[model samples]
Target: MTTPVTIVGAGLGGLVLSRVLHLHGIPSTVYEAESSPSARTQGGLLDIRDYNGQPALETAGLTEEFRKLILEGRQAMRLLDRDGNVLLDVPDDGTGGNPEVERGELRQMLLDSL
Candidate 1:
């Protein structure tokens, strides 16, 4: 008898789990409360770290695809005072440990991969 794997949510982790399971010929189902993938904005940007996120993407065989989605300069950070005075500003030098990518793009890519 084969027991099926059940996962909740269609977020990045859930989608990645499902994709990996499928890759190894495992049967699984993902239950997302959202009516659809686009029910709402995926929101903001995400900084996927090389030490952490890169390994996961490699494990999922999505390293190349993920690399293509990296958005340059998104990792830059800026701080301002209430009066809009610049307190501090740091620009992405393209050598940061983590690269920023649009949240929606990452979600869509994962969904598409699945």
Candidate 2:
């Protein structure tokens, strides 16, 4: 029989770990200090890279759900000078392997998946 796992937090890492373990028929319990998922506001944008976070989500079987939370046009970057001159401009051509997603939304998605 597989022993149950205990996770200390509900952050991305912990949630993802729980998810992956669950996928393989393992049981896990996540313990978070927060009273609830919405206990407080989470951070802002997170760049989920193809090499790391994307594969983790895929292993959790939440790639489609994660894709839905991606904010379009966020991959674009820009830089302006003091004189309001554009120093750099990078458009979001939808080719970036790293997509920006709201931290809170991602957390909620992971929580819901479990």
Candidate 3:
């Protein structure tokens, strides 16, 4: 029999590890400091780079789900002056290779996949 793995924290890394292990027919337990998934607010935005985060999610077999959490047009950037003049405007052409996703939403998606 294969021994189960113990993971600390239910953050992105821990959760991904657990999912990957589970896919390989292994079991793991994740321990988190929070009492529950919604115990606290998880606010923040992350750019899941194609070369980094995207590959990790693919390895965990969650690429499709991860893509669904991406916020459309978030890759665009704009700069305004005091006079409200647009100094720079970069539209999201969908080729930035780094899409944005809400931290909370991503966490929830990962949790649901487990």
Candidate 4:
């Protein structure tokens, strides 16, 4: 038998891959460089696209929980010129392909799912 799949780094991609594999009855061990979960700041924000990241999370069985964490109307994208003039500002109409969520919160959600 093969040794358990070893995953390095507890970042989004790594954690997502590990989670998906585990869903299919594959065993894995995530080797994070940080001493613990809060060893470093997770980052700013994340937008889970319905095509890739969201689907992967769905396959891993965390959609409903993820939905609870979705930050609606966070897609307020603004395009500004170098002179600090707001060229264009788009409000969140709930039609965006990506939904923004706090990085730390999203990571915690994934961790909890696992």
User: Which residues of candidate 3, in runs, are more than 4 Å off?
Assistant: 79-88
- Choose 2 or 3, whichever is better by lDDT: 2
Pairs that collide, model 4: none
Position 14, candidate 1: lDDT: 90
Q: What is the TM-score of each candidate against the true structure?
A: 0.81, 0.91, 0.88, 0.81
Put down candidate 4 lDDT per residue, 48-86, tens digits, no spaces.
898998888888788888788888889888999999999
Residue 112, candidate 1: alpha-carbon lDDT: 90
Per-residue accuracy of model 2 over 1-114 as CA lDDT, tens digit each: 999999999999999999999999999999999999988999999999999999999999999999999999999999999999999999999899999999999999999988
lDDT per residue, candidate 1, 1-114, as tens digits? 557899988999998888888888888999999999889999998989999887887888898899899998887899999999999999988888898888899888888987
Cα-based lDDT for every prediction: 0.88, 0.96, 0.92, 0.85
Better of 1 and 3 by lDDT: 3
10 residues in a row with least lDDT, candidate 4 = 1-10
Put down candidate 3 lDDT per residue, 1-114, tens digits, no spaces.
999999999998899999989899999999999999999988899989989889989989999998888888988899999999999999998788999999999999889989
Among these predictions, the greatest lDDT belongs to: 2
Q: Per-residue error at 111 for model 1, in Å?
A: 0.7
Q: Report RMSD (Å) for each prediction in the order shown.
A: 2.9, 1.3, 1.7, 2.7
